[model samples]
Target: MSTVEASAAASPQTGLRVRVQKLGTALSNMVMPNIGAFIAWGLITALFIKAGWLQGIFPALRDPDGWVAKLGGWGAYDGAGIVGPMITYLLPILIGYTGGRMIHGNRGAVVGAIATIGVVTGADVPMFMGAMIMGPLGGWAMKKLDALWDGKIRPGFEMLVDNFSAGILGMILAIFGFFGIGPIVSSFTRAAGNAVDFLVNNDLLPLTSILIEPAKVLFLNNAINHGVLTPLGTTQALETGKSILFLLEANPGPGLGILLAYMAFGRGIARASAPGAAIIQFFGGIHEIYFPYVLMKPKLIIAAILGGMTGVFVNVLFGSGLRAPAAPGSIIAVYAQTASGSFLGVTLSVFGAAAVSFAVAALLLKTDRATDEPDLAAATAEMEAMKGKKSSVASALVGAGRGGTISTIVFACDAGMGSSAMGASVLRRKIQKAGFGDVTVTNSAISNLSDTYDLVVSHRDLTARARQKTPSAAHVSVEDFMGSPRYDEIVEQLKQANADSTPAPAAPATEDAPVGDADVLPVSAIVLNGTGSTAAQAIDEAGALLVAAGAVEPSYVGAMHEREGSVSTYMGNGLAIPHGTNEAKTAIRRTGISFVRYPQPIDWNGKPAEFVVGIAGAGNDHMALLTRIAHVFLDKDRVAQLRAATTAEEIQAVLNAGE
Candidate 1:
């Protein structure tokens, strides 16, 4: 059965931490996806600015009377003038767009951009920090206004009202930004600059990591880099040709070290996934890839902190500094940004920080293995669950929710397809079967979630995000789309809610036999300590046992194979439910289930499975038994108990207990 990772419950003590993390994540979401823009800007600044590398490459470019003078003029004008405006104007607009989109969709984004223009124009420096703050706030206000006046507006005047309200709100916010927030922010920026100069003068640059590491993990790297560090570094670089401030948080070493540790010591899916993530992070300069890992185990923050401090210390000791910010935090970018005579120091800092982080992470992973193992296992199960779309009616019934019924349900995910599409199809079928034919079920990208849906379903990892997008809708979090028991619970609640008005459908003739009947799992059909190296082999073994008991025709095995080809039968938690399609109905001599337990897990598609249940039925005959089986698997410890059972009778007892 699929296991869910519930949303983390919040408490008063962690409130500050939670808020900081949320802010950081929001800022990161805005900036990280737009790394290409940052890269282009960084490259332009590095090559074309007054002290840029390009000037050194062709000395004639610096001579006004030389042939290359026009080239130098073009580079200088574009880099200093064009690039700064891009960051000043376009960056805030982009950030505003993302922040507004998060809260109130496209309309909010447009308003947010308009408001941000006020801040951008009011400040001498790029108004990224202001954009980050005002964009979402503006979007939120607009969203509330829209909701308050939702149906009050006349049908023919919706466009007029919406356009007027958004324009008015944007104008008000822009005026406030220019007149009020602008001067205050400018004063604060000056004060912050003074403080950084004090720290650098005292050689206390390493101390910045105390705040930087934690902030970076929260997704505030962009805000910190662009809002504070970049401006400070640019000033220092212009005067001294380099600034150590740029390397403080942009070093990829610490995150790379953490990922390497996970690749080496992490359990199950964590270990399996870390290697690929490490490559993307270390080479692609996408440090955001490691943020989730740090979030998963917050104590790892200590490792990042120490590593960052150590790297900064080394840079300070060697008088090492970068000429510009290293976009993407890749090692290559770091080296490219390094000034003359600083390569050795910068290289040493990277390795030293990585070593420190790896050592600490190794200890943490080892110490927390007991607790972390289950989460890793669950992640593995979730991965397997994403591969298929077949869900048994019985499994569907037991997995239903006890929540309030809704006429419209939307399945949301990061992307609109993949698991959400399959989940929508599964739930749609279950709803129809439960006599809720009039209810609408749909799938959508989480960003496109509408308030019109009565209920929204998403993966647990995305529950908070889904709520952020559609706060008005009831939300259900599921771990595995195909194997979630929540579906059964939801179906049950929906069925009851509509019972008075909607007529129940007649049961299929094949479901006449009760789920608990002894014939469903007769002792002769149970195989303990079974030997099979793959899912197909194990499934065939189970089918053989069923055939021996006169439960199915020999042709049923091929039918099961055909069904497996369409979609995996693996239901996760080391379990695979193998059954034939409706076309295989002629092969069923009797409706029964054959349970086979492998002594060791077998490869089922790319997933591992220890149990294979071969099912044969005429119409919906075996659905009741399948529901009971689903219940059995829902128990967290049931799979372990079944795996320990050495006898067919013991397995039989476990199956009966669920009934």
Candidate 2:
């Protein structure tokens, strides 16, 4: 059980580290369940397209045009239609829940949700694993995370909920191949073919036009039946428009072998919605998805960029005029009314997409191949392997930790106090060996010990005289000498005492605090600190602090757009809480506190909000900081105290001691 006796943590500095480890475990858990769904996602389609004919069980399946086989005119895929949703929406719940329960006991649910986000996001829509599962899982995880630490936990389900909106876009994209966006596009295709039917009956438009369409299918669809939406022998063999059906029948634009290649292979997202990019590019029409990747990893994206251009260029050269929409609004669709070479135009379109994508992917995809890192095809397999081992190990460790006195513990030193801090780190390792999961152990000079720390344990020099006056109520003293026999006995005794305690205060029933808190603290504390030589710099310092504390990765500041390239987090009212992401997994982390007074006010946004507050946290922790800080931001007295904090110590006293 977890409990917070008071707001007795030593300082925010120690809390950050524990958060990182917890989230890492969460990442491991989520990846497991999606492994199976992803592999099967690809396989489900294969049975219909790859099989020579409809087998015994598949023959009973419905078709894409008929949801029930009886609703013949409907545009949805009847047979394998639900298969896609099942893969994306339902599988993660089952896998995450089962995996969670089996591994971390109460916390397993939370861990499952944490890891599931990554797993589902790792795959395209077909193996998506909805936020219905992801949201609940994240909430459940946060709850468990709180249970592991003190009662001060935060709820963070909104991220996953927001993530689910993409599913709507995914469904629309899937249907584009079959529906043609309404009857208007269909009429357009027919109008052009009407006179041609006349020519065909009269012996004018060559039967070779049939070859032209097939050629377009080959190139424009950028059909990598090899990767996504492949042929299931069942659907393909059944001749039921449902198998290999998406390949030729479902038209997302006139087939930009270029866009298709990127949809199937390109893997860079400037931000939200990488999987949806395919639909936007292929049908909605934006080829920028290819560019983000090209920019992020030039060597990697080059081949695919060239491949896309090649496929598009070739299609235009061929005169393949698809009456349907072409992404980035290709020449095929634009030229549908243009004249004689429509057949050639269609051929060129297909070839263009295929050539560009293939070339670009081949050139950019520089895997040692021998390293056997299943970049695309075997990605799920690697995840499956993690499910079988690393997840189990991490969970077992976390479970044991939960069963002990500290479910979430932190290790700290100066700078959190480096040497004794190093000692705390060593003890942290021993505790880990004993199977403590998310315990936080930190090291900081005795002066800054008030705002965080459920209980404080320190070596010789870090005594009661130096620390007790600062903050942290629960202090356990030990000698600085690590090798001394007495210190060992004292540690063992504490371990036993903790193990022996009768009904240690049960974790408060209220559960983990929310991840996002827009309101909490009655007053705000602003700090200026970072590596940049200029005191005037105004990036998201809290986010940077979180990264340094091991609470979050450095990528979080960028992900949050807190550091929108040169933009300072100083909201300008002399206030800012730049934040970061713990997107990876749930773990306890130290919250670093510092006070900085710039010699001159830098140009933050035009608002002039510069009394900055920066925060770093797991995916769900920002709200707590936000809410607490917001209250502070509202206080004029607190702002004066923050402005007066000359030394880090003075800042600590004013911000934490008074609060």
Q: Find the candidate with the highest TM-score and give its number.
A: 1
Q: Poorest 10 consecutive residues of model 1 by lDDT?
A: 1-10
Instruction: Count clashing residue pairs in model 2.
Output: 133
Per-candidate TM vs. native? 0.51, 0.26
Q: After superposition, how far is residue 308 of candidate 1 from its true place, in Å?
A: 1.9
Count of backbone clashes, every candidate in sequence: 13, 133
- How well does candidate 2 score on lDDT at residue 640? 78
Give a tens-digit lDDT track for model 2, residues 322-392: 22112223333333322233445545544554565555554444442433222221121122121212122
- lDDT score for residue 508 of model 1: 34
Alpha-carbon shift of residue 217 in model 1 (angstroms):
6.2
What are the Cα lDDT values of the candidates? 0.69, 0.37
